[model samples]
Target chain A: MTFEVENVSKTFVSGDSDEEVIALKDINLTIETGEFVSFVGPSGCGKTTTLRIIEGFEKPTEGTVKDDGELVTGPSNQRGFIFQNYSLFPWLNVIDNVIFGLNINGKPEKESKKRAMEYLKTVGLEDFAERYPSELSGGMKQRVAIIRSLINDSKSLLMDETFSALDIQTKHKLQNQILKICKEQKKTIIFVTHDIDEAVYLSDRIVVFSRRPGMVKKIFEIKMDHPRDRQCQEFEDLVSEVIEMIGEVEED
Target chain B: MKKFRNEYTKETLILPIILIIIWYIVCDVFQLIPSFMFPGPTDVANSFVRLAVSGKLFKDVFDTLYKVLFGMLLASVVGITFGIILGWSKRLETLCKLVISILRPIPPIAWIPFSIIWFGIGIGPAVFIIFMGCVFPILISTIDGVHRTDPVLIEAAESFGASNSQMLTEVIVPSSLPYIVSGLKVAIGIALMCTISGEMIGSSSGIGYMILTSTSLFDTGSTVVGMLVIGIIGIIFDYIFTKIQERIFW
Candidate 1:
């Protein structure tokens, strides 16, 4: 699906105070179908806010998002969101959690379970189908969370720092796995994170945001081939370039 | 047998055994306390056997059990339904807050007069009293549980195209279960207290009635037996609820 964020801006009023915080300002962008995009910026930047607006979790104060020329009014199954934590239902076991969306949408129970099991098997979590979220490691839980969305056939996946809480090794493995999955499925992905290396490694295009009253500072296209080498000079240079942009925002 | 030999079981048994031995010595061996005020262990045991043989104990136990369970069932249905609605809607919760606060503080025993006038002195009054005592805790807990449901989870559900009812049943209810169960735990104790107090004042049957009549007749041994039976039932209910809590939280 093609997404157009037309001149979006967000303002937040503190609950007890009259002070207003401008989070985003005149943000405009377009994402092509099946393209992998990343939004990176310093803290208080509107990276997460932009992603939430696109997902229809939050509405922009002064703009609208159009998905394929249709107004995006609210959250739909067409766009799936993965939160930073507590995304899985603790009461549900792995396979059950995976099938939750399908069940809600009124898919056949037998078929839903069968499809959920297949997805779990693909992630090497088939043996853990009966286990609860609390029993799974952080990485494992994230894997389940990812599959939970993917199995619903969402056209675009919105991820908000979904791998930031994991250890380095688990994060790298998941990043690689997500890349493979998106490519194989040809799914559109919009990722929000502060990690520059991750943005350069996974994104086809990276949109950098300025510090709050966040505006789109720059957009970089990574021309590196798939399975890009993290140790290569070209990867390091792009990472540095993105880091410099964020550092400049932080300074301002 | 092995389960009973665990550290927790052994520690728990030590205090009760010591208390029983001290009671046996004071009441039976030394005659330190009058039998009328406090019966000896053998006297209570004899009274227990007599009541059991007469089948009155079984009848009284069943009567109290029926009142407690039935009252709780009614309370659960009403409380959960209202709780979900109130919790889901801020306007409703705010509208009912003042009335709920006023009613919640009034003791269940205080409702005895109204209960008698409304239902008369029988199982109906007893059940009403139990419902009064239990409903608030369950209702409040369910409300708190729903309020505490993670927004992230709700967002996730909404993004998946969950309708209002599906959101309530699938995300809200299950997430709030831990809170509701805890509320039920607190309510069970209140339910038992209401049952006994209601039966003592209004009913002609139940363990509460048995205790009241035995005390009036100066049959302290039988009264002690009645109290012990209530205690045992409380312990059993608590054990069952604790097991349920553990299973739900996982």
Candidate 2:
């Protein structure tokens, strides 16, 4: 499940006027199997656009994304996507939402339901299985969204600012939970965020981008072990370093 | 809250009771308006009881209901089917837009002459008119509902490899249920109107036919009864649909 973004560039033309807006230009990056990579940059840096290209939601103008050496063309269940607002189907209850991918793929209903319950239990949401998305709190809903993707056994997850809407305490709790789940399941995650602390906290590698018409400014390898303390001096120092890089990019 | 609701219900009855009393005074007690032209409350009541006892009122009511229900069923099936197809394909919808707009503005009653010519006098013409009246609202609302489907939800479905049909059934249809139900509510009212007018113009049976016959015979009491019965039916259908709308939204 390694992904290679080779010389990818995207240009969006305005509908009324023919003015071209370059979202990403000459982007090149390789994410290894089971790696947790975060794309961190300023707003409109095309970090999200780049992530979308890899997920096969948007096509790149110049190049292609290779998922395990197969050229990405369109959306596939093999790669799950998590949106910032937790786009769980409001009509579906928690268990139904989690099992949606499985159901659509024609898995046996009883088996899918059983497996969905197991996943919900891991997130301590088994009690909320019968409740619809509207009944759940923000954090709970996001957790359901994550479990929904996880249950599909997607080799990679393309998350676009998945936790940006949560309160601080909820965000930290989810970040910890996601870290544990991805580590245990060995699923590759390509996370997009403006939060440097979140990137440092979750990602194995943080790929920083330059402002609009974005390309890789730098890539930082976090050589920290699991359950890294945010209060630790090493964590604080790394956070500051990434912040400095982004600050310099902002000035430019 | 309970007491306030009770007071609200009581308040609603006051005006209707006052209107009935005024009508009684004008047409029955004083005998100002002739009985042949406009029946009093007592005359209408006696006419209602006579029709009910003879069973012609129930038969006419059933005939009208049958036409309305049959036509609505046809309209819903066709409307929802076409709506989903048109809603999904932008090109198809664009191509049909002009034709639909042209057809939609023509009132269902306006089609009565052609309907009578095509289907002949009886249930056929009435049903056709009802179908015509009901279909457009349903089709328009369903199309609107489809268009209003959240893009993110569609993206999520696509990402999970949901096929086009699967997307329509599982995601699109459920998301649009509220709008569809509302459209049905609108269609029901239109269907009733079409049934009455259609029956009055082209049919041999139904509440509208009874009203037409009674009025022409100068039996104003029976005519009033027919009108009141239609109003009651409309209220019942509206109440049922409102409950359905509430349930689906939740």
Candidate 3:
């Protein structure tokens, strides 16, 4: 359940002319078992690059990613990634979309449908099992995505700004649902986000990244309890503290 | 933008109507090309009525339709199968590029002499030409469709443990549906045109043949009537395809 990333770096050679753009620097971080971690930084700060490397979508230039003491080389069912983009099959309905992953695992059609329905109901989308993903709202789509990843029964989730498209109210609602699911399932989740409030609201720890050629500038442990209130002075102060950290890193 | 389409169509009719009036003035009013050599729209309409009464025209119409339909069906199956394979495997596609480039430039009409030599002077030769004309457009579009499928979508599938079969069936095909359908529409039109041309050049039946025969007999009105039918049928088929695209993909 614990995850470790050591000295990970990436440099993308842009264009046919081969201009080198360093995307990630020597990034070293460790995530504890069952802990919820969030990576927050400016756009194009290589936060996505780091998460991708951990999930084995892309190889790190200089380091190895270890998940629960095993060297991670490529994607495994042990870790689920829910992307920021909808990425739903427009041709498939809601439950079918959720069951899509399970069916790929060689689960029987009937059994996968049953399991999919169970997860759909968990996300409170039981009525929309037959409706296509294109018909779902942005927030509802995110819920489907979360359930889709959860259907694999993975113990860890690698979420890359999964709620970035939802409006404020929808984002809040889905975040609450994610928190609840994580709490009940005891799943360790590493979430990536640029929003200050979201990182504070969902994370057990927040790792701030500096600009281009990103490296971890600071890692803050949120000492506050679950269901943390945004109205609370401590929560607001912590949010401002993280905001200041982000601004200071950007200027530097 | 959508709200103004009806009004836009209505306004656009003015230019076409004026052009028709000018055409009428130049032909019917001016007595162009002497009466026997060039008939007006009225003569063409009369020829259409005469052909419809005798019922000989139906067979020609049926022949052309059957050839085009059969050819298009065959072309679609062959083209789509090859297209999927080519798009899915880059190495195989690269190897076949030399063959495809060499074969694509040969016009369907150019195949008529060979088609007759191979399949003989009947429906078989005509359909071959039609299929050849239609197949390339379809294959090209399918390759494009597969290429257009987002790499992110493929990566998402890969992450989920989707097998090669599953990825092809679930991710690649469904995502490429829009492009495939568009290509089919284009191919169908080309198939019909090639069918008409093939019939005119070789066969003794079909709408295109009717025009060829009328021209040889110097029946200008009948020739014009055959040309009109072919044109109308082409328009109708195109219209049907356009409607289906809007209805399904809307």
Residue A37 local lDDT, model 3? 97
Residue-level lDDT of model 2, residues A1-252, one tens digit each, is 499999999999989999998889999999999899999988889999999899888899999899999999999998999998858998889999999999999999899999999988877899999998878988889889988988898888889999988889878888888888788888889999989999999989999999877989999999999888899999999999999999988889
Across B1-250, the per-residue lDDT of candidate 2 in tens digits comes to: 0111112377798999999999999999999999998999999999999999999999999999999999999999999989988988999999999999999999999999999999999899999999999999999999998998999999898889899889999999998888898899999999999999999989999999999999999999999999999999998888888777656674
Docking class of 3: acceptable
Q: Give interface RMSD (Å), model 3.
A: 1.9
2 or 3, greater by lDDT: 2
lDDT digits (tens) for residues A149-223 of candidate 3: 888877788999898888987688878878887888888899999888999999999999998889899999998
The best-first sequence of candidates by DockQ reads: 1, 2, 3
Better of 2 and 3 by TM-score: 2
State the lDDT at B99 in candidate 3. Answer: 89
Q: What residue runs in model 2 are displaced by over 4 Å at the alpha carbon?
A: B1-8
RMSD of 2: 2.5
Each prediction's fraction of true contacts recovered:
0.89, 0.66, 0.40
Candidate 1 chain B worst ten-residue window by lDDT: B1-10
lDDT of 1 by residue, B81-184 (tens): 89999999999999999999999999999999999999997899999999999999999999999999999899999989999999999999999998899899
